[model samples]
Target chain A: MKAIKVQALSKKYGEKEAIKGIDFMVEDGEIFGFLGPNGAGKTSTINMLIGLLKSTSGTIEILGRNLETQKEAIQAEIGVVPDESNLYPEMSGIDNLTFCGSLYGMRKHDREKRALELLKIFQLEDVKHKAFKAYSRGMKRKLTIAAAMMHQPKILFLDEPTSGIDVASARQIRKMIEDLHQKGTTIFLTTHYLEEAERLCQRIAFIVDGKIVKTGSVETLKASLHDQSGLLLKLDQNMANLKQSLQEELKLTKVEEINERSLKIVWPPDQELTPLFTFFRQKEVHILEAKRMEPTMEEVFVAITGIEHSEEKGGES
Target chain B: MNKGIALLSILNKDIRNYYLKPPNISWGMIFPLAWTLMFVLRSETEVDLIEILPGVMALSILFGTTSMLAVTITFEKKQKSFERLMLAPVSLYSLMLAKTGGAIIFGILNAMVPLLLGIALTGLRAINWPVLMGAIILIAVTSTFLGLMIAVAAKEVFEAQTFSNFFRFPMIFLCGLFIPIQELPALIQPISYVLPLTYGVDLLKVAVGAEGILSVFLNFTLLLVFSFGLFRYSIHRMERNWMN
Candidate 1:
């Protein structure tokens, strides 16, 4: 059996659905990315997988064990790093990790050794004796992941692991994630940063409004955009407005913000770019450069989630 | 790998992080001391130290454990630290035990403050040591579990304390803390019997050689029952809260 097998899982909060009957699987020893915009049920799905939230309907199987019935058994072999740092703030970094190790039933000697090892592995050894609350934001995030890794679980679930941290720390964490993946831990990663998923995930699932609209290898998603191609629109100044305008005005499936001053617009090979150029000129936006490019994962995400149909389109100003 | 270690781990962490914090330590010490001073000052003549000893000790355990446990649990939840514990491999019962263990210890310690004070004031008398120990443990257990239930009932710390006071203040009046249950207005006497703390103080009364209104065996049995009932209910509410 796969490491994670979520089948038709759903979660309801009163009258609203947070996770709508979504299904996916994480192959053993591969990084599986669950990608979505905010409020797309990513956290809900992770909560269910980790046994914090029960599914209203459907099944979740972790390593062939039913999540509902075998939660403790499954929990014994799985570790999770939530978006926020949940370790005890007043405790030192080492204490927090050892405490986590103990929760997984690690012996005191072994818990201590593993906590020390993890503190070093996550580059938290320098602050190992420092109170968690005293550590910098990046250091705190690292300690949290170290705590999760203390038990040496077979699978690791990281939810927005790099969100709200400094760039250098995010880079370090991403590298650590790759190292963990290389060491044969099946990783279930949820992230909004498509670039990170493109770089790390072996297979990705795109969830929108609680439903998964796409699930396949990065290559499979790219393959679907065969007839389509991306047009990179590099501007003189940052214009988040340009991406929104393009998506709304053209009703295009893929117009993404590549960075502050650039957008990638995807369309069929036969579609004319002249109209977009005309629209840019009319909006008094200077195009620094425009180049043809292969369709990126952003295109696949937009194509899959069908963001073009998203309502309340910003009045095309 | 035993669950025993995990229980100890959580208890130790809670003691270090919440109960042993200087603010909490000060608060725990002040409650019993302040109560001792208040009643002492209120006496027009000589203070009857023995008469108020059991009441002060019971009140200390009740307020200290309930306030401290409710605040710690709610704070952990708000900070998402409790959510981390909930994800641990331990069974729910073990987890709950670990969570309340710190408060139980604190409750017993709070009772000790008044006991020592009483001893220092009146000179240690013919106190039944074993019965006093048992009563202290029972009261601590019952109060901690009651606090757990109140914490489970509310979302935020303030709400937990408000809900906690709803039960705690009534117990002070009805649980024979300041007044004998029989001397209270007849209409409120039944409320006294229903309170877990009342049974606890009754046991304390007998332990201290003061005549107890209820049978000693019945008081012990009722306190146990109340502790178990509150514990089970807290777990139920916890699971319910955890899901959504």
Candidate 2:
């Protein structure tokens, strides 16, 4: 069964459309990444799927149940870790987990057993008795995720799960995501970390300005932009007139000087390199190293959206 | 059946997290005890302690339930924990009942100490124990619903407290807690009829064998209607701002 299916889904706030009739599907047991910048309608889409926000138009089917009519049944099967970590601060970690489990109708012994097992898995067993207020930020994030998992949900939705955390904790969470996927848990993840999405998601959708620009596997996206890709060369010595000389000599429109000894030149993916090499040799650029620049997800995102990675954080194109 | 379990779980967590604190218990107890003590000590005329005892207990329940419900909702909203409840598999009805139910239970528990103390120290006795118990439940539920209503309109804890007092303070003066409703000025008598606490206080008067503005059946019916009406209103307001 498909974990989630959304068609013509839309959301409007006042006069502005937050999600403009976006459609997508998350296959069961796959890590489906919703890749977008902040306020790019990623949150609105997730909220609508989770039954928190009313969609302006369209239909959503989660776990084969209609979202509008069977929200409670769908909610029972899916776990959502919102953008915020919001466990009760005054309660102990165990207490919070137990309480969350109880809401799912877990029996006492079963709830306690599951809470303990999850605490150990999350490496929170040592501090299980401490109030949540005393927990570190990463620990709090983990606990919130753990709380969502207390009911052993069929699907999990994580929003910015590893953002703004220490590197060690982020690494652990990434590993955990991989582990969960391997164990046949369907995950619908939203993130700004392009590299993380590239590493984890089997398929990803790129959202910009409330619309999805592309949805495909990593290899497919990278191949799509291959023709516009560039080659980077590190020269033995600095060439003062390299930029002008390369553009004029090689008939290239995009040649950029990278510091003193490096130059990047764009060419068609299938173009021969011999001509460029001879051209550089004639100019005495004296290439020390040459390598093809396989586009990172960040680069693919930039190429598709025409927005810089840094500027994307502000959420406005 | 599942909703019942979810409701109980929510109530249990809320009681542990917000209601059973030492400060909450003391705050609920101190005001009524202090008020009753001052009234008894300052009276020059032959004071009927029995007549005043019910008012004191009613005030305790009123303040306890309303503040607990209002403050907890506002705090949960501010901290974003209320969204967790929204995401749970429980129905909205179960969630609302659980939240207000916790406040009602705590209010009744807080009232017991001051009530027993008054009965022991001042020789106060209930003429109709069942009516008194029913009145207590009615008042607690209605006041807690009022608190939830205020909470849905407020984004901050302080704002909720301020809005709750906007209703609570007026009811204290106009509900015949301190002075008889009939003795109030002619212009303000209509205001007493509108306030649910006026009916609650009248039922308490009936419980203690004092002459009340309304008959026992009338007060009981009015309080029930007010409680049900206010609870429904709170549910409506909550649906409008569920995420906020």
Candidate 3:
């Protein structure tokens, strides 16, 4: 079953289009990642899908129902963790979780027990009694996520779930997301962290300038980049005719002078590396070191979008 | 049934998080008590507590509801906590009801202090207990709804407070609180008809027999209309601001 389906979804802000007719879907129990930079309309799409903002055009279906007319029913079964950690500042961690459960109509005892369970899962049990205002940034993020899951929703939308947190917390949040997926919950995650998306998402979509430039699984995206090749070599000496000779002998496409001692070359997927090694040896290239490069998600992002991948270290801060 | 539970939960959190706090109580009490004190001090003869009771009670609801709603809504908006409530399974009506309901509860409680104090110290009494309750309840709802309208229009806490004062301060002087409506200039008399506080105070006056500028039925009808009208406007503003 498809947990979510969006078709020609568009949002316009006066003279500017924020999301220009994008289409996508998330299957039940699949972790689908929407990857983009700031102002790329990632949050706009999420907001529309969750019924917070009405789209200027197109339609959305969630949990086998129309998003426009069935918002309350869809909302009941879908948990959302917005980018901001927005729990009540004065309420304790346990109280915040319980309050969120109460919003979903959980019984008092059930909410209490669930709050305790989630507090423990998020490693917030020790500080459960402390006011949310007193929590560290990382703890606050974890608690916000915990509150979202208090009702055990079947589908979850996490917008930068691990943003602005310490590395340990980010890792814990990622692990929790994996656990949620393992437990059969469909997930829609939007993030700027290329590595996180690469690690967790079964399928990834690259959105740029209010449009989806590419969408596929990690392997599929990498496979699409197979035609574009990259290789790295370290040498003791810089050859004057390196680019020309490599082009002539090994049919190398693009050669970049990385540094004083390193060079990067683009070779076709069909081209054999043994010929390149032979060409280097024949040309008296020192060839101190050599490495074959597989495209990183960051590289894939930069290639498809023509935008440099400059996310904050450890996600968002 | 489930939505009723959710509504109570929202009310419970609001009361526990905002209304029950000492600072909130003190803030609500300070404004009305200060006004009462100023009236008592400036009087030439013995202060007629009954004469000013309606004004004090009306102002209590106005100040209390506006301040509470403005602060809570702006804070929730800034922190993004209100989104969670909007995303809940309950209707926007339920959420608005819970928020305004909480503000009304706080306003009534805050108003009670001055009313009880004046009754105890100056022997003021309500001639019709049911009418007094009806007037206060209706005023509380109207005031809270007006406060919500201001809060929805504002993006920040200070903005909410500033916008509230723009409406509140004008009503204080124009609503026949300190000066009777008949004594005001002929030109400004029509403005009192449009201000909900005028009807609110009149209802209070009729209930306690201080003076009835308008009949009981007229006062209740106007208050009811204003209450429902303000409520409709607030909900419209909220949907435009958030649920769009």
Candidate 4:
């Protein structure tokens, strides 16, 4: 069953259409990456799904209940971690989590036990008694995530869950997300880190300028770029003569010299790497490191959106 | 049933964070105590001191509710914590009610310090228990609603402080905090009638035996109307602005 279904969801802020009519579905228990450039309406759409913002028009069904008609039911089953850390700074971490748990009607003892367990998982046990003002950015982020998960929600919407954290912390967060996914929690995550998305998400949708340009499994998207291929070759001697011969003899698309003895080539996948090896052998040149380069999520993203993903840095939705 | 539990949980958190802390609780007590001391020292005549005691109590409620609501709300807005609350299952009205209810409780507690101190130091006479309780409830509700109105109108902390002061100062001074409305100029007395604080202080003074309880009831009823009206307006405005 689909855990979340959004159809023709739209939101406008004044004259600017924040989320142009868009549609998508998140399957139950799958880590679905809502991939998009900054300011691509990812947060706006998530906010609407959570009932935090009213959509200009559209329908959203969460856990098989219409969001507009069954907000309470849907909200009871879902949890949201907004991009910003919205916990009360004057309160202790434990206090924030317990308050969130109480909203879901958990008993005090049950809430406290659950909160303590979550704090331990997030490595915030030591800081549970301290006020939020003293917490670091990473600690705050972790606490926010813990708060969102206090009720053991069925669907979790995590917006940039590991942003601005250290590498170790990001890895820990990724491990935690994987653990949640293993336990059958459906996660709808929005993040700038394509590597994280590539590592975790079963399927990703690349949104550009309020429109979903592409959506599929990572392997499928990579296969879409099957026609594009690159070759890295190493030579024992200078390749100036060989480079010129290849440029003239073959329909080389792009050739760049890495060093005096190495070269990189880009061409259609249909082109024979064996021919390149034979050409190198015919010139009495040594061949080293000759293989096809697999496409990175970054490359796939660029190919789909026609804009480099790095260009959207520091832009928030 | 769950809604009641959630509301209680939120209310409990508000009280602990806003009322139980040493700094906040001490500040709440000190303001009213300071005003009580001033009134005791300035009351040259025995009757005049009795009159000033009720005004001081009213002032305490004003200061407690307005500053607490403004400062705390500004902090919440800056931290974006209110948005998190809005995302919860509780309705917006329930959230606002919890906040306003919490502020009223704090205001009542703040008002008590000066009234107790005035009775102790001045040996004030004939305190009508029912009238005084009614007056305290009146003042706390009106002050909190007014504070919420000001907080909702402000976009930033500085703006809230400035806007709160613009009305709070005049209401404190002109609404019989330091002087009786009858002793003020005729035009100013009419203005005082329009101010919620004026009605509040009038009722408090009547409770303290400076005026008639019947007159106080009339003023108290008007204050109730204003408080409810402002509370409704502020809640509506807040929902419009923050709930999206």
DockQ of each: 0.60, 0.59, 0.68, 0.52
In model 3, how large is the Cα lDDT of residue A289?
86
Q: Model 2: per-residue lDDT, tens digit, A132-191?
A: 999998999899889999998889999888877788888888988899898999999988
Give lDDT tens digits, candidate 4, residues A1-317: 79999899888888898888999999999999998877787888888899888888889999999988888778889899999999988889999999999888888899999999999999999999999989998898999999999989999999999988888778888999999999999999998888999999999998888888888998998889876567777778899877878877777766879898888887667765687777777888887667667777887888887878789655684
lDDT of each: 0.86, 0.85, 0.86, 0.84
User: All candidates' TM-scores?
Assistant: 0.87, 0.95, 0.94, 0.89
Q: Write the per-residue lDDT of candidate 4 for residues B1-244, one digit (tens) a residue.
A: 2777678877788788877788889989888888888877878876777777777888888888887887777768788887777777777678778777888999999988977776676676677778788878878888888888888988788887887888899997788766777789987888877888877777777777766423765877887799889889998888667545
- Those runs of model 1 whose alpha carbons end farther than 4 Å from true positions after fitting are A231-292, A308-317, B37-47
Best by DockQ: 3
How much is A150 displaced in model 1, in angstroms?
0.6
Give the runs in model 3 whose Cα sits over 4 Å from its true position. Answer: A234-253, A256-261, A273-275, A286-290, A311-317, B40-47
Question: Every prediction's TM-score for the first chain?
Answer: 0.80, 0.95, 0.91, 0.91
Candidate 2's C-alpha runs over 4 A off are A248-253, A256-258, A313-317, B43-47, B122-126, B185-187
**Residue B17 error, candidate 1, Å:** 1.7
DockQ for model 4?
A: 0.52
Tens-place lDDT digits, model 3, residues A2-88: 899989999987789989999988899999999876678888888998888889899899989998898889989999999987789
Candidate 2 clashing pairs?
Answer: none
Candidate 4, fnat value?
0.57
Model 3 lDDT vs. the true structure? 0.86
